[model samples]
Every structure is written in structure tokens, then in C-alpha cells.
Target: MLPAPLSEPQIRTGTAAAAPAAAAKVAPDAAATAPAAKTSAAPAKAPPAKAPAAAPAAAATSAAAASDAQPGLRPTTRRQWALAGILVALAVIGLTTIVVGLARWIAGLEPIAAFIAQYPGTYELPEGAPIGLPAWLNWSHFFNLLLIALIIRSGLQVRGERKPPAYFTSKRTGQKVSITVWLHTSLDVLWIVNGLVFVVLLFATGQWMRIVPTSWEVFPHAISAGLQYATLNWPLEDGWVNYNSLQQLAYFVTVFIAAPLAIVTGARMSGWWPKGADRLNRAYPIEWARAVHFPTMLYFSAFIIVHVLLVFTTGALRNLNHMFAAKPDDDWLGFLFFAGAMLVVAAAMVAARPALLSPIASRFGTVSAR
Candidate 1:
């Protein structure tokens, strides 16, 4: 089940940490008060030393209060409870959707074939589809495209103009392998497989409308989108633009650059390239995957440069909310959920990207410092 999206503010550790900071602030004030108390006792000269004793007592009391209340971090509000209920309902619906969708796909029927008994000539069809995909799988590619676009856009919003240097590498040569290269490549593979299935189905069905850019004014669309991206002039003479030129371009690049790299690298990894399988079978497996994989890092870096600029340039939260949420909020809560999703995406990227690239580069000692 898709987890209930967190609110815009709840995942905010930066703001949440302020509570402890405030508690810390209270301690200084108590310490300051102790010094003033000594001044007051100076006139009498009797209670001067006793004033110092109050500081430690106050500190201990403050520490005890903090310790007791630490258990109550993030006290739930009425709004949170309501949101939780909605999340549960949504999860049920999502689970149902999955069951229903899988039933249709696996049983090779339109819907609910798994739930109901089949009559004679009910057509026991092939599993999935002929072109390495099941029927109606094109929708997933579309979703993947949209999600990848949003991820890139949100990533751009977070880090733009300047790139984060490669996370890990060889210390001897100051060499660093880019994490972006690996991330974009993996997602590209998944996206491409999703897309390849769709493309195959499209060809098999002769549905060229989806693949062929049929609009006569496509050039104008590209131009206008370019202007919006370059000049930040949104409200770009619109008729419900599903994707702008910038969107199209990035998607196009992912398809062309990152996606191809995955296929090539995968070929190298699996030893599928230069198909003389029997003679040169001794060659290192997946080694060929490494040769073309590094360039993908550069591609990802370019994508990031443009991606982050648009996030803040457009409303970051608003842009992100549309990507992650099933229901649109158009409010702060929507943005928060978007943030939660992106944080997950970012964490996943950070963890996985390093794994994919680091081993490959280190194996060859071909990595360069970023």
C-alpha cells in the first residue's frame, strides 16, 4: 500500500530540532539569572556563595523535564489523526486497485478474470504479452516518464547552479566517481524496459498516434517551451500542454543518453556485445558495461544543472506535490507529501548510485576525481 503522505511540515527535522535549541536557550537564561542573583546578594554579602548553588539545581531540573517530555515528541494533532484515517482508506483502495489490475493482467482478461470463473472459449491467453510486456502496460511507461521528469525537476530544485561532487572515490588519486551516473542509469533501465514494452505493443497494434509526433505546430510548441524555460515566462500560450519542450527535451535525453547507456552497459555486464559468444566467452562478464557507463554520469550531471534551477524558479513544493500525490492539494500539505516522496527518492538515489558506479570504476581504476 502507498503510505499516507506526510504533511509539508512534519518531516521537517530542521524546524523540529529548534525545540531542543529552545530548551538549550532556557539553560543559558537560568545561568545568567544565577549571576544576577549573586549581584543582588553582594549588597548583603551573606547569600553570595549560595547563589552559585542555584545554577546546578536549575540545570538538573531542566534536564529532568527534558528527559520526561522526550517521550512525547511529535504529539499528534486532530488534523494528523484525520489525515491518518484518510491514508488508511487510500491504502485499502490502492490494494484493491493492485489486486484488480493484477487479476486482469495475469489472467489475460480485461478485469476481474482472476476473481470469476471462465466460461468455455474464455481464451486462455499467453502470459503478459508477446513483445516482452503485457497488454495495457504502456500506461506504466507514461507514469514512469512523468515520475522521472518530476524526480529530475525536484532534484533540480534542491541542487542547482552548482553540483554536489561525487560522493566517494579513491583517496590516492583524489579520484571521485559520480553518484548521478549510476542513479540515472538504473532508473533509465527500468524506464526503458517499461517504454520498450510500450513501444513493442504500439508497433504490434499499429497504434502510431502515441509514438508519432503528429501536431503540425510541434516546432512552435518546442520554441515556446524553450522560451519559458530560458526566460521563466510561464502561462506560455497554452492549450493544456501535457509536457513542455524542456520536459520533452529532458525526457528525450533520458531516452537517448541514459537509456542507451543502460542497454550498452547491461550488454557489457552480461557479455552480450559483439556476439561471438563461443570464442571470446572467456572475456570478463559485465566488464563491457563499464566502458559506456561513466559517460552517463556526465549526462546526469547536465540534467541536474537544469533540473534544480526550475524547482525554485517554479514553486518547488507545488511542482513536487503534483508528482508524488494521487490527490492534488494545491496547498502546503501537498508540498509536504511531495517533500517526503522526494526525500525518499533522494535517499534511495544517494544509497544506490554509489553502489552501482563505485564497484565498476574501482575494478578498472578508471575513476576520475570530481
Candidate 2:
């Protein structure tokens, strides 16, 4: 009746109809008004529509810059780390040579032995302390070594990751995480499990007496043992029956103290930890976890190095026999067991690749390529 109501497309086309008229009105002053024309017409053409869109883009850029500005962990460069290792190795060799020379030349090696013998640093066993390495202990030792090696490998990979090689997304909640992190956390769980088993067996079998300190004399004994070690006049090799004070203390710290500290700190930094628990996060911040976890790893690394060296250099056959064969007698059987254990360890290393892990990761969550 009044004119059919314009369709949606017609209304849109009507806006263009007014443009020619508007342009005609400004045509006479086109030369002088050109600049003004552009300024006036730009809003109609694009500005209002584009301005709102630009705000979000600008905000996103600012957010990214702010995130980049935040403080992050800085890892030592590989070259620097390698150089430090070389220096440490040289220092160990140099110190050992000098100490041995002084022990031999100054007062003869016998005096050094006498000094070690005179020190009252030996741990006196109570009634019926467990003696000799048990089969459970031998197996547990190998398992612990394997788990620790894998944990460290994955931990270093997680620490140095600049960009993840793959990602894991939760099937239920669509949460995403890096694959390296998955491996690291998985290894942590395994290590903890193995440790718990070791602890239970240790107590059940009365082997706690071997590692746990029973007397204050352990301190002086540890010092004496340490000095004897430094002078290349080590205490008697009797690990099958008993450990020296230094060994006892080291095992005590590793089992009772350091391990627990590592577990707590590691859990705090992991995905298993509950998120947005303000009080808990405040009490145990990520910074604390980061600070403790890394140094603990270094301590384990150093301990392993020195422990292995002493095992080999002090009495390889006896040490190997005790750990691998669970026997006091020296023979090639222990070495054969060691070789088999190493092959298992090697197979584990080979299977830890991203390609292999990605499929396994998919069972827990949706795995994606980075």
C-alpha cells in the first residue's frame, strides 16, 4: 500500500544510490576539498568498522609482549656445562694425584693407613643386623638405577624445551600439555613407585640398620672415611657385610631426605597438582619447586659419579659381585648380570623417543604434533 516494504538487499543497495548525489554536490570544489573529502569520507568507508576490530588485535599484541617480559627460567648453555664437567674431571684427577704423592712421600702409605685405622668412625651393629646383599636388594638396585637414569634424561629434556615436539590434549576437558612434560612426569611416578618398594623391602628385611644412623659416632667416622678416600688409602672394603660411615650417611640422605624433598617439590610443579588453590600455591610457590628440584638433580648426578668410580676403582669384582650376583665371591657372573641389566637400560632409552611415546601418550590424552 504505501510502497512495498523494501527487501533487505534493496535497503543495502539504496545506500549506494545516495553516494552519487553526495559526490556531485562536492564536485565543484574537488581540487581544494580533495583532502577534506578523503578525511570526511574515510569514516563512512572504513574507520568505524575497522576501529573496533583493531582494538582486539592491539590488545593481543600487548598481552604477548607482557608475557615475553615476564621472568623465566634460564638454563646453562651446553658448551658452558661441558666446560664445567671438563674442569671438574681435571680437578678430581689432579687432587687425587697430589694427595697420593703426599701420602706416599711425606710419611709413607702405612702412616695413612694407621691414621684411618685409629679413627673411631666405624658403626657398631646392634643384635643381628642384616648381613650380605639380598636378591631383592640386588634387583631393586638395578631397577632404581634404571628409573633414575630415565627420570634425569626426561627431566633435562623438559627443562631445556624451547618448543615442544608434540602435545597432549585431554580427551575429557580438552586440556593440552607438552609431550616432554608427559615423559618427565611419567618417569617421576615410576621412580617414586620403585623407591617406595625399595623402602618397604628395606624395612621388612631389616636392612634399615645398614643405612640408618644408629650413633653419633657416624659423623666422625664419615670424616675419617672421607679423608682416607682423599689420600687414596680408603677404608677396608667390606660392603658385603657392612658400609663405612660415609656410605651410610650418603645412603641415608639419598633415601630418607633428598628423595622425599624431590617428590614434594616435583609434585608441586607438575600437572597432578591442583590449580588455582591460592593458599596452597602461595605457601609452596613454583619458584621454590624450581629452585629445589634442579639442585637435587645435580646432587644425585654427583653422587652417582663418585659412587660408581669408588665401586670400580676400590674393588670392581667384589663390588660387582655383591650388587649383581648377591654373593661375596668375585667372578664373571656378576659382570654378565651387569651386562644384561645395561641392555635393558639401553632398550628403555631407545623406546623413549617422541615417535614411540606419542602413541602411548594418546591413550592418556589426545596427542598432537607441534
Candidate 3:
């Protein structure tokens, strides 16, 4: 379930390790008071040396406490039960890690390692399977990644936003919308366009053959490949030629199923759909769209995470060159291009901050905090 948006003030104040700073600031006062109190209670100089030695220890303890108080935004949640559940799960994982470490120390981890190494299955390519990934496919892959990531970011903003930081309005009709929603819808439109182009190019260049399964044997092969991956005995890296069955199946589902569903569901939820269409809305419930949309985002997120991990781990240089530099060879050019692309993404993220975005959003339409 989606958590409610945290307040702007809470987000800001919670960002710094304010607690530790406060403690450090108060400690000097306490030290001074202790010296004065001792002087009043007893006699003489009140052992000034004791205060100096204790000061160092107090400083050390405060610094240690500051380090323990991790420096980052502390998320504020209204749902204490849900927060408690997350904490409990984290504790369980920590305990499990300790248990595993102790067990390994007492008895060799060979048995545990052997169990993890068990992977079963065979991978086979159907006849006529030496097709290569084309240049257009590589370019489209990068573009699709960029657009989809932006869309997901904006979509989350729209969903959790209680008060829009900005707004967009139609010049012709004088209709207005929160800028968050406008950005989400606009990215969806762009994603749809990009997807359409990808689809056309895939079929035009006959690259669809690589992703679409041709035989029933593909299923068994996919199962085998999945098992291999689960057991950490991953399949061979040969994306320059045909993909393994599991990879093909995953691509097919993502391209043919998930993308289309995201577009359709987003469209239905957007303002472009005719309002007051009671019959149409009832026939295809908006609730169904709502239910499917978030999970689809999650699926895309998972796919991207695993895809990048494999791309790097399997063969970083070759994979980077293949996707970025459009060359199959392992070379520095691809790594350079990949680094540049990451910089661009980082810049976009920084530019997308509320303060930076609100003014641009105002240019298209009226903008207000609420």
C-alpha cells in the first residue's frame, strides 16, 4: 500500500542529524554547571583537571552518538503498525545473518554452499537462432530506460501528492491540473510514442523473432534458465546473438504485456478520457486501472534492477559497449558513453527538484504550493 506524503517541514528538519547536534550543543553547558556546582558544594578549585578529562570523554561519546545517528532524511509515517512491521523484518534479517555466521564458524559452510550451488535445467535455442541485436534496438533500449524512469518518478509524485507544488493549465480551454499529474501524463504520452516507435522498428527490422517464442520447448528452457539464475549458476552471456529462453520470455512480457497495460491504464486515469461517461467508466472500472498501475510500475522497477545487475556482473565492458557505444567489442568508448549517460541522469534528477521545476511548470500554467 502507498504511504501518505510526508509534510515538507518534516522532510526538511528530519533530513539532518539534528538530535546529535543538539546534544553536543547542550553538553558544554552541563560541563560548566557541574564545575560550578562542585565548587559550591565543596571547596578549593573544584578539581578543574577532572572537568578537562571528563570533557574529552563527553566529546568522544557525543561524536560516537552522532556517528550512530545516521545522517539522512528520517521518514515520518502515520502508520506506526506498518513501521513496526518493517523494523521487525529488519531485526529478523539481522538475526538470521548472525546465526548464519555462527553456524559457518562452528561447522564449515560447505554444506550450505553445496545447497546453494544446486541449479537444474538446460538451455537450447530453436532453429535459425543466430540473430544479432541491431543498432536501433540498442538506442531504443537506452531511450526506453530514460523515459520509463522519469514516468515512474512523476507517477509516484502524482500518487502521493496531497498538495501540488505546481500546476499546468490548457491555454485554449482554461482547464487546469496539478503539475505533478501533468508531468506524469506527459511522460506517459512520450513513453507511448517511444514504445510505438520501438514496436514498429522491431517488426520492421525482424528483431521481434528474437523475443517471441517459436516452440513449446521454449517453456522448459525458460524454466531451466530461471533455476540456473536462482542457484547463482547463471547462463552464458551471449546477447550479441540470440537470448536465452528466460531472457526472451521476460522481454516478451515486458514489451508486449506490461508496456501496453501501463499505457492503457494511465490513459484511462488521465483527464483526456471523456468525463461524465458513466456507462463507459462503469463498464471498465477505474478501480481496476488503479489496482494494476502501481504493480506494473513495481514490475518495471524489478526488471530494470535485475537487468542492470546482470549487465554489469555478467560482462561489464562488453555489455556497456553493446548498449551505449553500439559496439559488440569490449572497449573504453562504451564505458565513457555510459558514464556520460549517468551524468545526464544525475543532472536531470537535480533539475527535477521542486524549487527548480516549479518555475518551469508555471510557464506552461498557473503554479501554487497547494
How close is every model to the real structure, measured as TM-score?
0.35, 0.73, 0.66
lDDT of 3 by residue, 290-315 (tens): 99989999999999998999889998
- lDDT values of the candidates? 0.51, 0.84, 0.75
Model 1: clashing residue pairs? 8-336, 156-307, 156-308, 157-308, 175-369, 176-369, 265-289, 268-286, 268-289, 269-286
Residue 279 error for model 1, in Å?
A: 9.3
Q: Quote the RMSD, in angstroms, for model 1.
A: 23.4
lDDT (Cα) of model 2: 0.84
Candidate 3: stretches off by over 4 Å: 1-130, 354-370
Best model per lDDT: 2
For model 2 the TM-score comes to 0.73
Stretches of candidate 2 above 4 Å error? 1-92, 98-115, 171-174
- Give the alpha carbon lDDT tens digit for every residue of 1-370 in model 2: 5988999647865876787799878877774656755756633364354545776897799888887887453467899899999999999989879887875554345765565567634778668999898999998899898989998888998888898989988675566789888888888888899899999999998999999998888887888777767667677759988898999999999999989989999999887788789999998899999999999999999999998998889778889999999998888888888889999999999999889998898898888886
Candidate scoring better on lDDT of 1 and 2: 2
Residue pairs in collision within model 2: 121-221
Lowest lDDT 10-residue stretch of candidate 3:
115-124
